[model samples]
Target: METRELRYFVAVAEELHFGRAAQRLGMAQPPLSRAIQRLERRLGVTLFDRTNRTIALTEAGTVLLREGRAALDAVAAAERRTRRAVPGRPGLVLVTKAGATGELLSKLLDAYAAEPGAATVDVLLCQPGEQERLLRDGRADVALLHRPFDSTTGLEAEELYTEGQAAVLPAAHPLTDRPHLRTADVAALPGLPLPRWPGPGGTYPPGPGPEVRDHAQLLQLIALGRASAILPDSCRSHLDPGLAAVPVLDAAPVTTVIAWPPHSRSLPLAALIRIALRLGSEHGSAALVRGG
Candidate 1:
């Protein structure tokens, strides 16, 4: 009946565990259970068969679950359309990664703020999976990410620039003596402390070697001879004292890209894209000057 009840039912149906679903929704299990019960009573059909050991969706429940998701999507799309049509306000939310994209966004926001009739920009620092989820759910209007994206459908992507990955090492490490260190050299090092690999959403992947949450922690770890990390050139700007960033040998450069739901090509988004292109051009010019 109510949207909230339908949402709870759908979450439980998808997760198949009331406890886990409640946790994901940030609510108590009892309340989620109550909402599901209310929905079931209204529909006169049991959506789930639950016992102490297991939870499974019934046939009727499956049909309703599919329909419920579609209905929710339609409602969300409608809301996005209505919001965009409102006067004197920017209706888009931009989500991007924390390092270079974050910096680029700040510059764009400054320009936008100076313009008349600029839309509101909500710049969210999102994890890899979060961007996909936000775009899919109509919660985010645009996203910028380091490639490779897991999925391409329902979105449009533009390449911004290629970024080299650097191996961040301790100052006292032998590799620091060189201007650049190869990936093989790193992999061959005995007892080298390597930072944990980042997952699809830019968070440290599960399981561990060494995990550093920020540039300072990364520097501290490397300085103590505890570990090394491979990071993009953009991240180099964040390096702390006593850390050396050497180029990784023979590694493929990562690409930075801007992505958005295919339908979000508003005037503001176009302007932002132009700004990004200009910044990329400027960076290229600077790189050429340094090389020369």
Candidate 2:
């Protein structure tokens, strides 16, 4: 099916209402209905179950919606990559969560620049939960993603390194003196609710914690005794003077991975990835030493 039809179907599938989907698409309902009907006939399957008051996706509709979204993302990536391929402007755009990757990013960029014929690399710092969307939609060529935190679905990725977690708290907090703390110990701390980060849709989940956009803001909140956080142990290197981090012995280890679109064949991206893997390996021992 054409991308237009796929887009219309996806809208209807997501909204579960033809009229609403048409409005979202900025058109009237009649043609939208016709388009969906034609698509269903061409595909030889019913795409939706419709009634007087509501509509629902059929089993086949569910499958198409999943595959269609991927197809649309691939098309968008192709268009963006092509537009960016201007002559004599060769470069790679790397995205990662701000205030998170820290020294590892610095080392990777420095190492990549030394390679022969290395293209210029531009770094884009974004909030957490945004790197995957940027990479998938072609706003970014590659990204640094942490597993169990960032979703890497529909992307090619390689593990860089893994590090244990820690609970970052106010310097004067009673728990700061402990050699280490468990997740439960951190969770039970009164009046220091963990900061709630915005999800992919940019909305905060329901919680008592203050809404946070990035690590910098979260750290500030922690320093003021308004919040606490469980973050990768590497965060200790960047903690401010008013804050301290105690290892969370039972927290999950976070794995940092370098990811890109699966269909990408860019030589510069390959070179960057190679350097990142090497640096990650070289520094794995050091990261472990620091975490300990």
Candidate 3:
């Protein structure tokens, strides 16, 4: 019922281990366990399936975790906005992946600034998969996310562009000689495996190649013949002679979307969204994907 209980439950549900969750929360295991148990009792729901050796979320626990995260986000948003509402300082934070959509971002910013009452936009560049956290935790007000690849969960989005993908490889690589590729062809390269980026939970998936945080790392690894990555075709503009990008026919198209929390209320935030949509309408190849 309280933020403390919700916070404890979320940690346990995510880690699925009381001891690890307790360590993360800077507490001991028994109290964390008791807090979760008390929460379950108060709600009359079995939140977890626990044994001496294993702890797993029940269906009810899964539901609670999702809802509890949103509740915590709302609380964080309230605290952040309260502090930011100073008399002479109004600003907005726009977060996006570095080296992605460079041209479009420049234009979007220029257009938004032309508006009569635009707030100063602080552009925050982050690593892959970090945008979602920035928006949800009140660190950011808006984000330019690529969906189907970027997770747009718990946010509203307006599509900005859509384009195909390409497999980036070393110039001398055998696959570079091919006219194009399928997704399977890129995934099956003998000497080079796809570089793994950290998942939303910040854990790298099981993989063979180097772990990468952004396109710069991925490109450096590819240049050294250490890895290959299938990235959006737009990445071609940024590649140099050392790297060659061949289109991947079967790879899904990447859609760039401007995403924000649905609960946002700032007039400046709304104005920025309007400017971005206008640009997308005039310049984007694909139709806008509004929130469902």
Top of the candidates by lDDT: 2
Instruction: Report the C-alpha lDDT of model 3 over 30-127, residue by residue, as the tens digit.
Output: 98888887888899999999888999999999999999998998899868867876766779889999989887889989998888977999999999
lDDT for residue 35 in candidate 1, whole number 0-100: 83
- Model 1 pairs whose backbones collide: 90-119, 90-120, 128-201, 182-249, 183-249, 193-227, 193-228
Off by over 4 Å in 2: 290-292
lDDT of the candidates, in the order given: 0.73, 0.92, 0.87
lDDT of 2 by residue, 103-176 (tens): 99999999899999999999999999888899988989999999998888878999999988999999999899
Model 1 alpha-carbon miss at residue 215, Å: 4.7
**Could you give candidate 1's per-residue lDDT for residues 140-208 as a string of tens digits?**
777776675445565687777776778887667777778787888876666665667466546676644
Clashes of each: 7, 0, 0
Ranking of models by lDDT: 2, 3, 1
User: Model 2, residue 23: what's the lDDT?
Assistant: 93
Q: Give the TM-score of candidate 2.
A: 0.93
- Which ranking of candidates, highest TM-score first? 2, 3, 1
| Candidate 1 residue runs with Cα over 4 Å from true position | 1-9, 15-86, 114-116, 127-129, 149-152, 188-192, 197-207, 212-216
RMSD of each: 5.3, 1.8, 4.8
Per-residue lDDT of 134 in model 3: 83
